[model samples]
Target: MRKVILLFAVSMALSAGVRSAEELSVDLMQSIEDTNKSLSSNIALSNKQAATADAKELTQMFAQVETFFDHKGDAKNAVDLARQSKELSTDIVGFVAVNNFESATTAATTLSRTCRTCHTFYKKE
Candidate 1:
């Protein structure tokens, strides 16, 4: 039946989209981890320029994550966590601009923890 074929096609498209999203999220996660480590090191060294750049990149990435969750429409807590992490990234940029590495470090730690919390709750199989 045409109805059955249409339903099957729609189901296939959705499954493919889910698979693609998972792959993209995995790549994004790896990049975030690398950037987070670089950010911590930059903060420790008091590298204002590098730290600012890292924080900005983190903010952008978290925004992407927030958008991803928002589109999925199933993970409210994940969306909130991503937003909180994005705010922390922005805070880190401000702290680095002021040469306040201590506060920036603290914010980075908080951001890392926020990421862990989200992963714990919303990790993909």
Candidate 2:
């Protein structure tokens, strides 16, 4: 309950700065990539605090992706993948909170794979 409220507060605060304009997908993707690396490293180190922070940020970023895909309305698969990524991010936060580094690592791996799968379909080569 406390974590959920904190997450909501953090998410709202983070998104507040960008109220002037929605982030371009490219910019958002770059942010996701950078945050993902931090998340993976922190999970490997069993740094719960850092991992949780990164995961929370990722969860928010993937939510943005989900909204982008849903609004585009051309790729249901992308929307699904985005949602899966978001859930995995949240899972990582929970796993790390409990000192379950192995499970957190697994969730992070799946999250990376999910992003790559979406890129295979949507990214221009």
RMSD to native for every prediction?
Answer: 3.1, 13.0
lDDT of 1 by residue, 1-125 (tens): 99999999999999998887754467788899999999999999999999999999999999999998888787899889999999999999999998899999999999989988987888866
State residue 80's C-alpha deviation in candidate 2, in Å: 0.1
Alpha-carbon lDDT, every model? 0.91, 0.89
Q: Cα deviation in Å at residue 101, candidate 2?
A: 0.3
Once model 2 is optimally superposed onto the true structure by TM-score, how far is the C-alpha of residue 102 displaced, in angstroms? 0.4
- In model 1, what are the clashing residue pairs, if there are any? none
Per-residue lDDT tens digits for candidate 2, residues 3-121, read 99999999998788565244346778889999999999999998889999999999999998898778777789989999999999999999998999999998898888998898898
Q: TM per model?
A: 0.85, 0.80
Residue pairs clashing, model 2: none
Candidate 2 lDDT for residue 67:
89
Candidate 2 stretches greater than 4 Å from native: 1-24
